[model samples]
Target: MDKVNNFELGIIGCGNMAKAILSGIFSSGFLKPHQVTAYDVNPETAAATEYEFNIRMAGDLTNLTLNTAKLLVSVKPKDVGAVTDSIKNVFAPGKNTIISIAAGVPAGFYEKKLNAKAPVIRVMPNTPVLVNKGIAVISKGKYADKEDLEFAVKVFAGLGEYVIVDEKLQNAATAISGSGPAYFFLIFKLLVEAACDLGIKIEDANKLVLDTMEGSAEMLKKFNSDAGHLIKMVASPGGTTEAALDIFMKKQLDKIIKAAVNGAFNRAEKIQDKILHGD
Candidate 1:
């Protein structure tokens, strides 16, 4: 093992996704404790993240890549400029691969900010990444070589599944995966609340929702059955399940959910345009 094939990983921000990657990289033995370094604007957050992961912590972003690095930029969209500004003057071109997990920020922003033809890989990952079950969609900027893009995909695969996507479809990716977790969580909450209304204890309600969801997901995985077929499998004709299905259909559930997702997609586009062009 080229112990450093994992690379001397550097993280520019210690937010949730950053921490999740830190935990995944360390736990998976892809990198040793001394092989990773991180820097965050908040001194306390930087210290806490470092302490938890047992990695080196830099006091500033400029110092983050002092060693040979494969940097992951996990900062917020608005704060990317500041983070990039702090390190742009110091970052080495072609020697490092930069991965950005900020939603709605285009690769062009990074290219202009870095002021160098640095290999930049843009990724959109969901919140489930924290649990090591994330779906990440990635795309390469013009600066990224084939090897750089492959290594970037490998890093994300260490955390979860990854899809090679086109930059133009990023807004759809943001809506489908980045915000999809919240949508599923909302459905889970509603299911649990309904169970509780039927006199199930809160704890039992939670277990029921979790078990049912997990079982359904597992069945889908094994059977390769479409959702409609899966629903039919559970709901016998003219039974209790059919009664509930009737309500869901009467309420236009599918149409409503489609509208909800599209709304999210449109809002993501608006934010990107607003930030990039102030439209």
Candidate 2:
């Protein structure tokens, strides 16, 4: 029997990403620890999140919707409608500014579901946010204004870089930044494996590949050069770098990358639970 209390931020889903966001916002000092509460359909989950963050756990969605001035909806796309149904009746039209981090789901879907005229802000943040290095792409719904956008930016700013994009471009943004980390991680993993195959010790391979990846990024930024320019700089004629790069060129790596990114972009658009009002 958790008592209903006014919370500046009420979390609809208290999962890993939600916890990451909590950590970031706490570090940023934008919202006090006492100003946020977590709500989950599974009471045990709410209790667990509450224990970790020392925030109150809401016993029900109605109480959370009615009491919290702002809310963060971090549920899965398929579960969004159920959460929306439970809150729409109690949701405060002008008071609550809802921010969603659900992948693939657009802000418009939430707005249509609520029909309460509350502002909806959609965010796509990668898992890197767990380590405070994530990039979040945010897009505002029709009802969201500068104030709502400002609040959204401040929350994620503590984690990593955030860019505001048009709702139309959200899927492409998701493809590039949201799914981009996995692509880089896979490449790094393969590089480590390839180094091991070349007879390097596992420990040395791990360090070498990781350090090279980090240093390469730094070099690009420090030199104000694109990756193509760096490639040319590294692969001197008839050198080992040139030999390896020639193999990659023969494999059409650039085309392979473009196809992979394009696939992700198309998948992003199809993954949302987009239910219109009349449909």
Candidate 3:
């Protein structure tokens, strides 16, 4: 058994996202495994995480809160209330800060359940954090100060880039960055399938699609120009790229994407309403 060191940060849920956070923090040398403790509802999961990351496993929610000054509530949005209720008494105002990554859950929800003076930071982070290339949008609660926001930013920065946004804009962020990867992935899958249909080998199709996507992303990053500008740069008059782009434009791909993103945003708002009002 690995001897547990005193922990400064506690994770309330030991899911994939939490594990990604641990990996990023460890890789960045921002925090060691022993300095962090974690808890999960499933004993096996917690034990596996302890062994995999060499971090301590808290006996329960109460134990986790008691052991660390900063607590990350990474449970599902529906489970947030129960987790907050369990640790409300242990959470000390001005002494402890709670950062929540539960989608659609607001900081005020935690503030109402936990100590009013305890700072709460709400974050929406995507799955790409597993590769240390994710984007996180953070929002501060009424009780949270600039210092608290900065502290949360530093922790997330270990995973990737971060932006500070108002709580009202969190749903849009969730729709764009939170669900954006899946959209890109679907397009990649379609492109690969199209290449395969064109008689390319499966492996070659995958490589071609991925390399093209990677190169395009790098070009966009390097040029610091809007995607439309880059598209114009690539598609000359009477060119193959322009021909393909014309088909997409005629099919109203932009409108379809806009509607799909709006669908995600609306669903997020409805979920939050349900969590907040028990609708």
Candidate whose TM-score is highest:
3
Model-by-model lDDT, in order?
A: 0.82, 0.86, 0.88
lDDT of 1: 0.82
Candidate 2 vs candidate 3, TM-score winner: 3
Q: Which ten residues in a row have the lowest lDDT in candidate 2?
A: 270-279
Q: Estimate each model's TM-score.
A: 0.91, 0.93, 0.94
Candidate 2 regions exceeding 4 Å error are: 1-5, 273-279
Positional deviation of residue 276's Cα in model 2 after best superposition, in angstroms: 5.5
- Mark the regions of model 3 whose C-alpha exceeds 4 Å error after superposition: 1-6
**Candidates ranked by TM-score, best first?**
3, 2, 1
Per-residue C-alpha lDDT of model 3 across residues 1-279, encoded as one tens digit per residue = 542324768998989999999988888787888788999999999899999999989888887877687889999887898898898888886667889999999877777788667688999999889889999999998888888888788789999999999999999999999999999999999999999999999999999999999999999899895888998899999999999999999999999999999999999999988877776
Clash totals for all candidate models: 0, 0, 0
Report how far residue 105 has shifted in candidate 3, in Å.
0.8
**Of models 1 and 3, which has the larger lDDT?**
3
Residue 233, candidate 3: Cα error in Å is: 1.8
Where does candidate 3 clash, by residue pair? none
Tens-digit lDDT string for candidate 2 (116-155):
4669898999988989989999999889889889999998
